[model samples]
Target: MTVFILVAGAFTGPHVWRDTAARLAEEGAEVRFAALTGLGGRPGGPGETIDLETHVEDVVAVIDAVTADSGGEIVLVGHDYGIHPVLGAADRRARSIARIVHLDAGMPRDGVPALAAVPDPRLRVEVAERAAGELPPPARDAWPRWGSTAGLSEAALDGLTALAAPQPLGTLLQPLRLTGAVAAVPVTGVLCTGNGPGVEMLQMMVEVGDPALRALADARVAFFELPTGHWPMLSCPAALAETLIEAASGGGRRLTAADASRPPAHLRPFLLDVPERARERAGNTDLYLPDGPGPHPAVVFVHGGPVPAGARPTPRDWPTLTGYARHVAGQGAVGVTLDHRLHALTDYEFAAGDVADAVERVRADPRVDADRVALWFFSGGGPIAADWLTGPPAWLRCLAANYPVLAPLPAWGLADTRFHPVRAVSRAGRLPIVLVRAERESAEIAATVEEFLTEAARHRADVEVIDVPDGRHGFETLDPTDGAREAVHRAVGAVLARLKG
Candidate 1:
């Protein structure tokens, strides 16, 4: 017999898991819903103050009672914010656990709070500004900030809003600590496709050879997909129940781990073989000046990443950035590369500031023409380009995007429109936009690129698209064909033509 303990996510309580719990129980499994403190009509404790540890204790109490009363193997299922407490409890009860399930939740690290998992940059900022002890759940209409409620009906949506609780700021602000023992437990991931990445998308992410994501490729991790929204219990309880049962039985898809011996596509040699130009290191930026430079037109190449803060050979040092910078310098223009604090999605504000400061620094340099300049963005860093598009500066000549994601991916569930370049492009009267599109781009990025062009068309924005039919996301280093090189040249030439006064 399998004993299952289900922990509900934030703004919800065990009541939210009623239908799913019943299904699991009917399937001959003993189900217990962990009532998170201060949620679902539960009495808010002394002073109404609760935290991650408080919830951790709540789940732990259930685990202890269930373990003490029954001898069956324990399977813990945590959804959304519930995963933190699940992890917290799992860390303590690793020896007693059988399988752990992460149901549309983040893989949190030790000392990282739940707030780190919040997708929107603006929400994170707003929470900080509030400085309140507890954070109230978003109102009914603002539910998308939590996750996509694509499949929820009107009644379910109403129930969600009505039963939502005030989340203690400490629950999000406080960090989760763990022991290494939890690594031994087998894990299953129940992916709600509507709210986040499906199994295929997750496999694609793991294939990128991101060390952080390599854990997903581990044999211990298995994945199950449900074609529903964040509220799986409320959307498709039967399918979710079936998936949970299969997950408990260890029947699911697995991701193939990337080869440890091989370097990731990005680390491979750059496609371009241009001569390395003399580099001038300034504040958070590197400048490559053209030969006989006298206030030469400057192109600031912005490298994108929600790159790890500790990621070595930073974005500015990457071959793609350096290659583009060198190529621009060889074309009798100054190429500038800058390091920004876009280590996470929430860091976009700081990254934009860094880009702004770098641009000012570049314009102030004697080698760069202050009046004639262009800004180019790459990959995930594309959204940061929204700053210049909404209001084109007098000196701004053009903007270029190379396989950039102009809008947020569906999985991010961000409500903030501040970083969305697709919406901002309409504000640019006739600012030249040279977009280098990769036909073989990732679906998430490609989808947004298509949306951006559609929006750009509606507003009659000045846009020129350069297509690379056989290119990939990071085609500069990933796809080393003549087409990739030509596309790069065309994009740069277009910017140069615009910069020519």
Candidate 2:
């Protein structure tokens, strides 16, 4: 019914789409694979002056030829670096394309080269260094290292590697030029969740109206996730093909501006008016306020890692932390998440002070029940909240921690605080605590958590321990399993129950 044009990423050719195209063809669709200039076994070698514009010409030529032959609408799909040329072509021929699919690829804006989208500074530098010449493909034997071999048979790997070729450096170095017309075509993103953090960060950028991802802001674009590696065609071809068919059929869910502005279905976003001084030091605080009225019990989320110096915190920056905040909000409490300075080894006390200030700001909010507040700490944030747990305020209802560091990390210069959580829990005085321990926790963190729990029990401190046998430290948001979800649900329920009483 529709013509499907597939474009492979750099260093690969049309052969990369062999399995997917075959499956789609069997499903009764017209499929054509577009081998970009200088890619695949094309006559020209990598040194051939093949730039982004040349690739765009290649895709546009295919669109013209396919449309002229069939007179049917076209679905243009681009993977990885292929996205740049496909997007450029779509912008040039917006009326001819029905839908555009970005498969685990970077979405570049006008005037930005594809290389600018690379997130790692070192990788960016490496690319720049190689910009003068052809960028060689990974060795055929190292397919596994490149993620192409995951879930694929040896024969499939051999076939893929044989088809690989050196990519022209010009394609990545050249900037993409667009007149904004491409937004007219419906866009669908089939994201690979194995790179969870990166995808989450992109979603956040879209949410906050970051101009870099403005193309996705168009109402025509939607996103779907596949729980596989970057090369989904090899890892989960069936699922990828099915998603593509759905997108082509206009049956996929759309991502709208309203969806981006609010928290997920379970929670709502709120802006807290922190002291101007606190805002100056730690940016702003985003609160995921639960549904319902009248002063609800609340929890202040202290996220791990002071972000790198000069790196500002965005809602999408720490997916795991933000996800837990939403979960806590879903369970009938206002979940407050803030951004504080990344602490140097000697700056733990200063960081703690900033967190305390955030807590005070949250308590002052009229929507929060100031009398029933709890502190939930994660990773490096654990030591920052130790003071509150040690001698909690009378209004503080409970404390919930997940794979937290109860003792100082001497390596980080986090030591000799007035009250260590392990030593202070004994005198915490009836303050209830819920600790969720990840089975795959680091040895040091596990040992510290063990000692803290032991001391709590010996002192008769009111505490509950929930073990997530299948979870890693950041399981709640990071590699979530059914067990992790259930563990988090129960943990939040416990904290809420205590606050309610």
lDDT by residue (tens digit), candidate 2, 97-132: 999998877667899998765543344577788736
The 0-to-1 C-alpha lDDT of every candidate, in the order given, reads 0.84, 0.72
Judged by lDDT against the true structure, how good is candidate 2?
0.72
TM-score of 2: 0.59
Candidate with best lDDT: 1
Residue clash pairs of candidate 1: none
- How well is each residue in 1-501 modelled by candidate 1, as lDDT tens digits? 888899988778888888888899899999988887777536665676678998898888988998899978899999999999999998999988999999989899998988878766567677766664778877999888878787899999998898888887878878899887788899999987666656755664565435778898888899988777788989998888888889889989998876659765566778978897889897689999898948899999998777767666677888889998999898888999989998766688899999999999889888788999999999888989888899899899999999997987656745465889988999988899999999877655676799899999999999999999799778888888998888888888899999985
The local lDDT score (0 to 100) that residue 282 gets in candidate 2 is 33
Cα displacement (Å) at residue 163, model 2 = 3.0
**65: Cα error in model 1, Å:** 5.6
